[model samples]
Target: MTRLDTLSARGRDFLGSTHAIMAGAMTWVSERNLVSAISNAGGFGVIACGAMPPHILDAEIAATKALTDRPFGVNLITLHPAMADLIAICGKHDVSHVVLAGGLPSGAAIEAIKATGAKLMCFAPTAALAKKLVRSGVDAIVIEGSEAGGHIGPVSTSVLAQEILPVIRDVPVFVAGGIGRGAAIAAYLEMGASGVQLGTRFAAATESVAHANFKRAFVRASARDALASVQLDPRLPVIPVRALKNAGSEAFAAKQREIANLVDAGTIGLAEGQLQIEHYWAGALRRAVVDGDIESGSLMAGQSVGMVTSVMQVAEIIDELVGEAEAALSNRAA
Candidate 1:
C-alpha cells in the first residue's frame, strides 16, 4: 500500500480524499478561489464564513461549486448572529461538511447541521471538550492550538495531540496549528491524528486571494515575529488573537489601554468597553488581506508563517506536503 493508504481509515473516510490534509478556512482569504483550488488539488478546502451574512455565504458557496465538484467544507463561527441561516444555506447547497469554530456550538445549531446529513466538525481545545463534543454529535474534531492564526486557544498543537488523540475514539481527530510541512503531518498521523489542517502554510498559495504585500510579509516573517494579541488590563475581557506583530498590533495595545481607562472612569460600561475593543479589529483583517495595507491592517498569521518562502500553486503545495510525508514514513519504516 502507498503511504497515503497508511492513513487511518477514519481520516481518509472523513475527508474523502487521497490525502487527509485540509486547507484551513481563513477569513477573507478563503473565498471561492482558494477553496476550490485546494479541493481540486486533492486536499479539502474550507470556506471561512467569518461573520458573513446568509446571502453572502450563499453566493460564495455557489461560486465555489462553479469552480470544482470536489468535496469542500464551510467554516462558520459559532457566535455569528445568523448562524442558523448559515447552516440552512449549507443544507440548501447540499454541502458535505460544516465546521463550527470560535466557541462551543449550541445544541440547536448542532442539530440543525446534523439534520442536513452534513458532517459536523468542531474545534476541541481540550481532550475533555473533545469527548463532550463527540457526545454532543460532532462527527469530527479539529484540535487547534495557540500556534494557529487569528483567534486561538492556550495550548500547543503537539500537547493537544498527545492529550486528545488517544482517547477520542468515537470520531476522527485532526491536528492544526504550527503545522508547516509533511514531516509534521506524518508524525501526527503516527500519534493517532486522522488528518491535519493548516492555514499559515496555505495562506501564501498562488491561488490564495491575499494581497501581494500581505503574502510578502508572510515570506519575510520568522516564527518569533508572530505574536498573540495582549490585554493591557486584567479586569477587561480580551480574546487572544494570533497575528504578525506590526503597526496594527501596536495600535491595538494602545486602543485597549484607552478603552480600559474609559471603563475605569465609568464613562463607558465594562461590556461596552469590551465591545469597543472588539470593534477595533472588525475590518482590520480585510484591510490587510484585500487592500494590502499591512501596516495598519491585521496581518493574521500563525507561527508557521516562518516556513512559507514563496508563492506556489495549491497543487504544488499539496504534492510537496504529501511527498515529504511519504518520505518520512519510508525512512521510519527502514
Candidate 2:
C-alpha cells in the first residue's frame, strides 16, 4: 500500500479534524457562526480577523468557543495596522492555532505567538520563505497558489507544494488553492501534503454568511471563470486579486481608466484619489456575500467554483468529502 492508503498519523494530530480538510479563513465569510459549523463538522475552521475590530475579534472567539469544543483557529492578517493587538487577543483567548496571512508576522509578533504555545501557520509563496518560517518555529505552512480567491501568491500550489514537501520534514504542509472536492483532496494527499485547505467550497456552504447571490455565482462559475483581475496599466495601486470574471470586474476596470485620466490631468485630489480596493470591488463582494446580489457585486471564488453545485450543511459536506477521499484511497489500494 502507498502512503496515501493510510492517512498520515502525524497529519491528523495537528489538524484536529476527522477529515483532512481545513476551511480557509475569509474576511466577512469566516465569522463565529460559519467557523464553528465547520469545526463541529470535523474540519478545521479559522475565524478571519481581517476587517474586525479588536473587541469584535475577541467576542467572535468567545462566541466560537461557546458553540464548539472542537479545535478551531483564528486567521490574523499580518499586514493590518492593528496586527499587534490582534496577536495579543489570540494569546489572551488561548487560541492555539493562528493562521497568519498577507505577509510574515514581525519577529516580535512571531515570538509572542510562540510564547503562547500556539501553532503558527503562515502562507508562503516561495520555498525559501517556507523554510524560513519553519526555522522561525512555525508549526505548519500553507502554500497558496495563484488559482485561489482573495489575495493569491506568485507560485501555483501544484509547483510549490511539490517543492516544499520534500525539503521540509520538520513541519506539516497544507496545500491551499484550487482545492474544492474529494478528488482534489486525494490528489494533494498523494502528492504528500499533510492536509488540504479549501475556501471557495466552504464559502458556498449552506451556513456561509456570504450573500445568496455570491453562492449562486460560485455555483454557476466554470473552471475558466477564475482569473486575476487585469489592470489596464502597470501603475495601478491595487494588487491583482483572483475573482470570478463578471460584470463587477469590468466596471472596476472601467473605473480604473477614469482614475488614470484624473491622474494624468492632475485633477485628482488626495481625498478623491481612488484606491481600487476602496471601490465597489471589495465592498461589492460584500453586497454579493451579505445581500446575495450577483449582478452588481463582486464574487470571490476559486477555480473549483465550477465544481460546487448546491449548498449543503457543513457536516454533510465534510462527511461527503471524507467518504470520497477514503473511498479513493481504498480503491487505489486495490
Q: Each candidate: what lDDT? A: 0.91, 0.81
Candidate 2, clashing residue pairs? 210-289, 211-289, 213-292
lDDT of 2 by residue, 38-127 (tens): 999888999988778798999999999999899899998786778788888898989979998877778987898888879889888888
Which regions of candidate 2 fall more than 4 Å away from where they truly are? 1-5, 267-280
Positional deviation of 36 in candidate 1, in angstroms?
Answer: 0.2
- Please write out the lDDT profile of model 1 over residues 259-324, one tens digit for every residue: 888888989998898878777776788899999999999999999999999988999999999999
What lDDT is reached at residue 45 by model 2? 93
